[model samples]
Target: MNATAKQPISMNISALPGATTREMLADQPMRMTISKLNFWYGPKQTLFDVTLGFAANHITAMIGPSGCGKSTLLRTLNRMYEAVSNARLEGEIQLDGQSILTQDVTQLRRRVGMVFQRPNPFPKSIFDNVAYGPRINGHNQPLAEVVESSLRRAALWEEVKDQLHKSAYELSGGQQQRLCIARALAVEPEVLLLDEPCSALDPISTAKIEELLVQLKELCTIVTVTHNMQQAARVSDFTAFLLTGVMVEYNPTPQLFTTPSDPRTEAYITGRFG
Candidate 1:
C-alpha cells in the first residue's frame, strides 16, 4: 500500500530454531513469516517473542485457551492492532519476502484479508456485499463476474445465485459467514486470516466452512485461530499451540496432535488443562 521504495526482506525460517522446520514446511514456500514478535496493549504485553512461518497454500491453525493471544498474534499479520489505542508491536512480519510493517495499512489489508468470528455481512444486497472490496480497490474486472467467482469459491454461489439482489441479512447464519468470506476473497488476497470463523455456526455450517477452507488453499494461504481442537485437526496442515502469550509448540498438525514435543501442548490438547 505504501508507495515508498524499500528493500525486500529475506526470511530464513530454518535459521530461526524452533520457528519452523524443513520437514514441517516440506516443499511449500513461506507465505508469511513472523520473527521474534512482541506486542502490548499499553503496558500490558499480550504476545512475547513469538516466531512462526505460515506455509504457502496451506492452512495454519493457531490454537490456545481464551486470552492466550491467539487472536492477538493473528491480528499482527495484517497490523490490525493499529486501531487499538496504545497498542504496540515490535518485530518483523514479512509477506512474500516484503515487510508488511512498512506497507500502507489500507494496501496491506487488501493483500492480507481477514474474516472475524461471527458472520458480518453488510446491510446491502448479497451481490453488493461481494462486490464491495473490488469496487473500493478499483478493480478493472466486471463486477458480476467477480461477485460470482468469489461466491463460488466460498461455496455459496449456487444457493444465492437467485437472490443476488436480496439483503444479506435475509441469509442464514452460515450463509452470511460464507458471504463475508466471499467479500474477503473478492480482493484476491495472498493471505487470508480468520479469527474463529466457524465458532458461531452450527455443525452443518461449520462443515461447509471447513470444506471451503481446504478448497481455498489452492488460491491463498490461510491462518486461522480456532478454539475447537477437532476443527484445527480437520482443517489445518500445521498447528501452533499458544499458552499465555508464548508459543508452546508448532509442527505439522498430525505430529503436534498425536505426539507434541512440549508438555504444555500435550496437556492442553489432551484436555488435562486449558
Candidate 2:
C-alpha cells in the first residue's frame, strides 16, 4: 500500500534571474536542502558532513572525480540509498520543507524520480516504457497523453512519434537515454535527480539532453551529478564541487568555474588535480 502523503506543497527559494553568489544563498528559496549529511556503507564512510541548498526551479550540478561521494549524496536526496543493505546515512534532506528521511518511501519516489548514469530503457515498446511509471503510480491523466507529453518534454517525440509501438531497444543509444528520461517524466515528479545522464551519449545527443534539462527546470527542480565540467557550465545555474567525501565549495556555475572562492575548487577545476 502506498503511504499517504499530504497535498504537494510548493517551495519558495530566493533567486535572482541570473545571480549566483554565496551571499545570495540566505535569500534563496530552495526545492531541496541538505545539512550536516554523512553516509556510510556499513563501517566505510563515503560522505562527510556536507551541507548545501538547491534553488527551486534550477539545475544544480554536482561535479567531482570518481568516488568523490557525488553520486552517494545525490541518491540520498530521494532516499535511494535505503535499498542497499547496510547503507546508512545521517543527515537531514528536506523536500519543500519536509524531511525526506521521514517521508513515505513510495510517495517520495513518486515525487522525486531518477535517471541513471547509463540509459537503461526497459525491453518494452517505446510507448510502454514511457507509460510504465505513470501506470504504477496510478496517475490520473490519460496514459497515451502522458506518454506523448513525456516524450516531447525529453525532446524525443518528433523522432519516435511514428514508432511508438516499436521495441525501445531498436532505437539508437541516444533515443534510449531520452526514453529513460521520458519514463521518469511520466510520473510528474517534482524533482529530478540525474547522475551522469550524458556520459555515454554522442555529442549531438548530449547537447539535446542538456537543452532538455534546461527547459525542464522551468517546471521541476533538477540535481544532476556530472563529471563533465563543460556540460555543467553549459546547463547548470548552480554548481557544487565535492572532494574526498566533503563539499569543497558551492557556488553558481559561472562563479565556481570562473572565479572559485576556494583554492581546492580551483585546483580541481583547473586540472591541477582530480
Candidate 3:
C-alpha cells in the first residue's frame, strides 16, 4: 500500500464548549478495549473500574501523579501484573475483540510487546539483543534482516550498524533504550506498551525516543505511561488522566491539554495540584 500523508488531528476547539468531557475525537478503529477493569495486589486495590479504548496506529498516553496507578493500568493490559503473588484482575481487556485474558500468555505477549523505563539490554552483542525475541519465538525470517529492519524502525540502526557485534552494554544510555525498542519491534507486535521509556534519558535522547514512537505508530498501537506532561502533550494523540486509582478523564491530546472536561484534569495540567 502506498503511504500518503495522514490526516492531521482536529485540534479546533473554537466552538466546542471548554468543558468537553466526551471522548472519540474521530471514528478511529479500536485496537484495545478495556472495560470495568479493576486490579488488586494482595489486599489493596491499585486500579478501580478503569475503562478506556486505545485507537489503532495512534499513541495513547497515561499520565497522572506519582501514585495514580498509571503504570498499574498499563501493566494490567498485558497481564504483566500476574507476576506478583496474590495479584488479581477483574473485568475485561480485549485486543481486536478477543479477550486478552483468554489468549495464550506467550502468544499474547508476542502480540503485545513492552519496553520499560530503564534500558535493559542483554549482556550480549547488539545483534543478539534485537534477535532474541524472534529467535525465542521461532520467527522464520532471516536474523540479519529482522535485526536491520527492527533497528532502522527504532532509529538506532544507523548509529549501531557498524557496531552490531559490540556488546549492548558498550552503548550509551539513550542508545541502549533505543536498542530495547528495537528488541521489542523485532517480534512485530501489534501493540507496544512503553512504561516511562524516556524517563531516564537526556533531552536529546528523549526527543529521539519520542520521534521513534511517532514513527512506530505506523506499524503498531502505542500505550505509554509517562510522568512528563510536556512529553504527553508533544507525542500523544490521546491522553488519559488518573487520580488516586480512578480514571479522571480521557480525551484527545489537544482537548485534554487545552480544555479538559474535569476541573481536576485542568488543575493537574495547570500545575495547581497533582
Instruction: Report clash pairs, candidate 1.
Output: 2-104
**Quality of model 1 by C-alpha lDDT:** 0.90
Question: What's every prediction's RMSD, in angstroms?
Answer: 6.5, 7.5, 8.2
Q: What ranking emerges by lDDT with the best candidate at the front?
A: 1, 3, 2
lDDT of 3 by residue, 219-274 (tens): 99999999999999999998998887778777889988997877778999999877
| Per-residue alpha-carbon lDDT of candidate 2 for residues 1-274, written as tens digits (9 for 90 to 100) | 0121111111222432345375565466888899888789999888777888888889999999998899999999888898899998887889999998887899999999999998999989999999999888897889999999999999999999999999999999888999999999999899999989999999999998999999999879999999999999999988988877877778878888998877778889999887
Better of 1 and 2 by TM-score: 1
Q: For candidate 1, write residues 141-208 as lDDT tens digits.
A: 89999999999999999999998999999999999999999999999999999999998999999999
Compute each candidate's TM-score over C-alphas: 0.93, 0.91, 0.91
Candidate lDDT (C-alpha), each = 0.90, 0.86, 0.88
Instruction: Flag clash pairs in model 3.
Output: none
Q: Model 3: what TM-score?
A: 0.91
Q: If both were scored by TM-score, which would come out higher, candidate 1 or candidate 3?
A: 1
Best by lDDT: 1
Model 2 CA lDDT for position 215: 95
